[model samples]
Target: MPDLAARLRIEFHWRGGPDVVFADITEWWRDPVVLRDLPPALTALVPGPVPTVVLGPASRGTLLGALIAAHLGVGLVEVRKNDRMALHSPFHIARDLPAGYHEGGARLSFRRALVRPDDRVLCVDDWVESGGQALAIQDMVAEIGAAWLGLACVVDDLGDRAEVRARLGVRALLTAEALQAD
Candidate 1:
């Protein structure tokens, strides 16, 4: 996994959408080398007291969380994003998240039964930019009386928002600038 960061940069690309430049990690997912190296790499980002259970925020996080959870020999909790299907399904939603796709309406939910008061949680995502999701997840973890260890992602794009990462205990295998390398 020594060359993982380098390989990640090489496989990473930027996709131009109608209004934005989104990162395309499809190539990373396709590379067996990356798949084999990623989980351990992300797990290493967290200092210690490895999580007993991991949390992924729907979509990408769900996939990444499963991999990393397996690496740590732990379990995963899938966090749903504003999905009506979660209503009354033992899922608790995090409130008052920062503006995003749904603005202030952004919400994150998770199954309360899956999380316990003494469990340590490490949230996994492909990328972390605004950190609103991590904060929201923290709220839900706190509500369940679980310990929120922090966030672990493939990429960290906090820019000048260093304080946010500090506040949320964010860590990543690559920085946004690392993927921009030539």
Candidate 2:
């Protein structure tokens, strides 16, 4: 586990509140110390050579994913929470994210001609608490027949990386832990 992952896990598990952990984790990325520490931490967690696509909720996870993509020299993909008219022909797939509402009705859309068939996608997010949203992005990648590289987050409170990997069929990378020891 990378040091950032440990820190994120601690932060999400300890300092974050029920309604606020998602925002808290996202906000942490804005801090210079945390931002500086993220890329290396993410690089340490990924297990293989698949490229990345970031799954963000409009304003939430976009910057983090974009930064990581820039650092790794890869592309970024957005998973929108609401539908947009411009994405008329986007490839649609349903996902159930951790903190998002609904069991499985959440949908993800990309610009129609954005991704190629041969693209291998690593899904990035700001946090992975329930794995639902990540799973949804994974489903979208599968629908496009793109190789599902892996899932990376700025925080992971679930603790069990194995289960997350098993469910999403990709290793989960977290940058920090919200929990702290006294």
Candidate 3:
């Protein structure tokens, strides 16, 4: 496969305090070939097939998680950010999320049906930063008596790599350094 990282464009986004550089893969993903190849490229990152389910939060994470789960031939479970679905015995975590998330705070929920005591899950997302949500997910997984195989992301913008790894093993396709503008 081609060097996908090098093909991405970078855009500067202002998030109140400072300008944040974002790796814009949306355009590159528009290409049918590239979109088709995403699953294979991401599958290469996983160590092995240890997870019975792939868990992703709403929005971007949910989209990518579905792809990864399909590639791995596992069940895809969504952690909802809203009460859109009628939940049955859901596990919830309310906390101060990062800037891009809900302003004051966000409530994250995982349905009891998707998460089981014996499940071995893989967490997938578009990006991971601050790791607040991921940590909360980890806590919920533990409470459910489930195992976390690892976390995979399209990008790693968060600087504290060690801290994130300490909490949950992570594999990122691209780092913020690689996404910086020329």
Best by TM-score: 1
TM-score of each: 0.90, 0.70, 0.79
CA lDDT, every model vs. true structure: 0.84, 0.60, 0.70
Ten contiguous residues with the weakest lDDT in model 2: 173-182
lDDT by residue (1-182, candidate 1, tens digit) is 44988888888888897898878889988998888888998888888797999999889999889999999999998988877766666555555566654345566787678899999999999999888888888888888888888899989998889889998899888889777764
Best by lDDT: 1
| Full ranking by lDDT | 1, 3, 2
User: What does candidate 2's lDDT look like per residue over 1-182, in tens digits?
Assistant: 43655555444433457765323454465456667787666656777774745445445567777777788787776667656543454345444344335444555555534556688776766666666667766776777778876766655645566676576644445433434331
Query: Judged by lDDT relative to the true structure, which candidate is superior, 2 or 3?
Result: 3
User: Each prediction's Cα RMSD?
Assistant: 2.3, 4.6, 3.7
**What is the clash tally of candidate 2?**
22
Assess candidate 1 and give its lDDT: 0.84
Off by over 4 Å in 2: 1-23, 50-57, 86-105, 159-164, 169-182
Clashes of each: 0, 22, 0
After aligning candidate 3 to the native by TM-score, how far in Å is the CA of 87 from where it should be?
A: 8.7
- What is the model-wide C-alpha lDDT for candidate 3? 0.70
* Cα lDDT for residue 94, candidate 2: 44
